[model samples]
Target: MAHPYLAYYCLNISTIPENSSYQSSLSSLLSSISLYATSEFQFNKLQKFLNISDPLYGLQLCHGDVTTEVCRECVATVAKSLAVVCSRKLVALIWYDECMIRYSNESFFSTKNVLPGFALSNIQNITELHRFDQLVNTMMIDLESQASEVPAGSKKFKTKEANLSELKMIYSLVQCTPDLSTTDCNTCLQEAIGTLPVCCNGKQGANVLMPSCYVRYEVYPFYNIIDTAPSPATGLPPLPPRELEGMMNFFFLIFF
Candidate 1:
């Protein structure tokens, strides 16, 4: 079996000019995120705004199927990577197979900005392209609706499967950060699903990942269907105070 914990991609947006206050604010924001990862996982998503001099804002969302421990690991990895890879960037976003982490100078909570998202598709084309397109369109629309209607305080996520043939099936998953209202979540997912024709038409499998939301479908089962309940949030693992110093050193070693 494939390991459930993996990283999919990373996005390093605009950079921050060398400003001491901005750097200090970003450092504090990173520490806050690390602490959140160590402690909270119940909702599988977190959105926080730091009211510092620079006002850094961030959001982190984990795939609902993963355990709280897995979510923590993914968050830690991204936090470390971003500290180095996006050291000077004002906006940094990273997507792990199990979770996502983002931080920026501007506020993005509950806002739907879908540009800069990426699409990936299998190289193999489906023989029944037109029919497959129709099926995907219908299925994604239904999933977008279902995912947006999570029980109060639960993760905004849903997974479903559609039969392409007796032996062939298409598995789909859709999710948004729980902080988003139902309407915003639906809108974000709808926009992503609508881009199927442009990005993944005729491919056997495809996925589009955005900061606010992401939609994925594949010929094979890729999600854990058995565990539908969300994990409870908690505190971070015991870390020596020097851990942050080490993280900072790691970033500097890589870029400087």
Candidate 2:
């Protein structure tokens, strides 16, 4: 089951009054977003409920590789949970494994938000620290570039893998909300990547989750390789051989 990794509410802001116009609008907004999950056009929805004097702006995003069924489940889960979890705050954000849901009294669309981010890391540490760190940094930088270069309407997501040694490999993924522009997406990713050394340096695996974008890496594959495309939307070329030479093994080693 998908669980929330983080839940943030703007505590300084006033909470919505029970049965008020704002509350009604919020309910309608979330309901519409959840209902749209069944659509085939895209896995995200940016919506607003403007019937009331105070409007509510919201968005829902599912990870690029999840199935439609999973996306629907995740969206529904967060939509219902946010109201209770956030205590009817004027602004709130929640992150789940399969999806993310956020809403505010004011419009936040197309803006880059990085505050209230969180990081998760494996308890185990890598034995080969320096080499592993170098490989992860290189791969993440490449993935960030590719993910952020997509056109505005396309999914800004990318995944990559590299063999760290004959017995081990590294898998990574980076993503941004499609609504963000290329420069904003790139900036968000860079900030997320900068958190690794502070939060998960030398760990076997780690994830940086932000409101605008996220970056993750692990020794075992945590994402669906088949569900996601192998390249970004712009068809950018992969890292040159010289850049990856001596740091990564292109061939996969199978152990029976």
Candidate 3:
């Protein structure tokens, strides 16, 4: 069977040649950071921008759940693989594994840009339209609160549990590159949130992703918490049922 998270769609923008230096630097940077990471950001002015002629740079934040080896491997693949896949497109994206990679000459930082993104239905949907709307809307509200209250320093991504009732629960996650301005990040995600009704209307599971952010909800946990890192009792509550949804079908949105 296919690896988890393999059946997902993606969206992104990348400025390759102009940002050659950015990709080069990205390769080096990933070689340094530990375990899984999920982020897409541009480089600081001090660092050499990827492509000289373009003068634009790229940045990325990997999903925090990934292991160091996997993150490095994924990034490396983007450096090589994207070149072959995207060919000459200045802005491109590829959904490779649980790792989504993208590079763009555009100032993606703090700037919210969305598109007519896509969603692959799970061959399931509720017959009652009204009930469906309520379920999706309510779940989104809960996820929004958790995302805003995300604890970690750089990672503003969160996977959470919502007690729909004693009998049922929902697993969800909301994430934005820490570099994103709250407004831009929130807006981009809100767009993804908005897509639920239109695209995933009745589907049992869906991943709504935008260029700068994404939200996912399903019956199972879809993350690989890198460590036994105890969550401090500040905002995020314990994984409901105190169970780590081992083995995630991560929907990484790659951009090149």
TM-score of each: 0.76, 0.84, 0.64
lDDT score at residue 106, model 2, on the 0-100 scale: 80
Worst 10 residues of 1 by lDDT: 247-256
The superposed Cα distance between candidate 2 and the true structure at residue 148, in angstroms, equals 0.8
Give the local distance difference test score of model 2.
0.76
- Candidate 2's displacement at residue 32, Å, is 1.1
Model 2: residues with Cα > 4 Å off, grouped in runs = 1-7, 10-12, 39-41, 50-52, 229-256
Give a tens-digit lDDT track for model 3, residues 131-166. Answer: 545766787776676565544235657665554445
Q: Against the true structure, what is every candidate's RMSD? A: 9.7, 9.6, 7.2
Instruction: Please identify which of the two predictions, 1 or 3, would achieve the higher TM-score against the true structure.
Output: 1
Task: Indicate which candidate wins on lDDT.
Answer: 2
Ranking by TM-score: 2, 1, 3
Write one digit per residue (lDDT tens) for candidate 2, span 1-256: 3233443445446888998888878888888888888645345555555565688888888888778888898899888888778866888888776688888888878888887677777667899999999999999999989988998768888898887898787888999988899999999999989988887877888777788888888776666766665633322333332332322221111111
- Per-residue alpha-carbon lDDT of candidate 1 for residues 1-256, written as tens digits (9 for 90 to 100): 3322222333444555675667767776776676676434333333333344566777777888777787777777777777776677777777656677887777887677675576666556788778778888888999899878864355788877777877677777898877777888889899889776777777777777777788977666666655642431212222232432222111111100
lDDT of each: 0.67, 0.76, 0.51
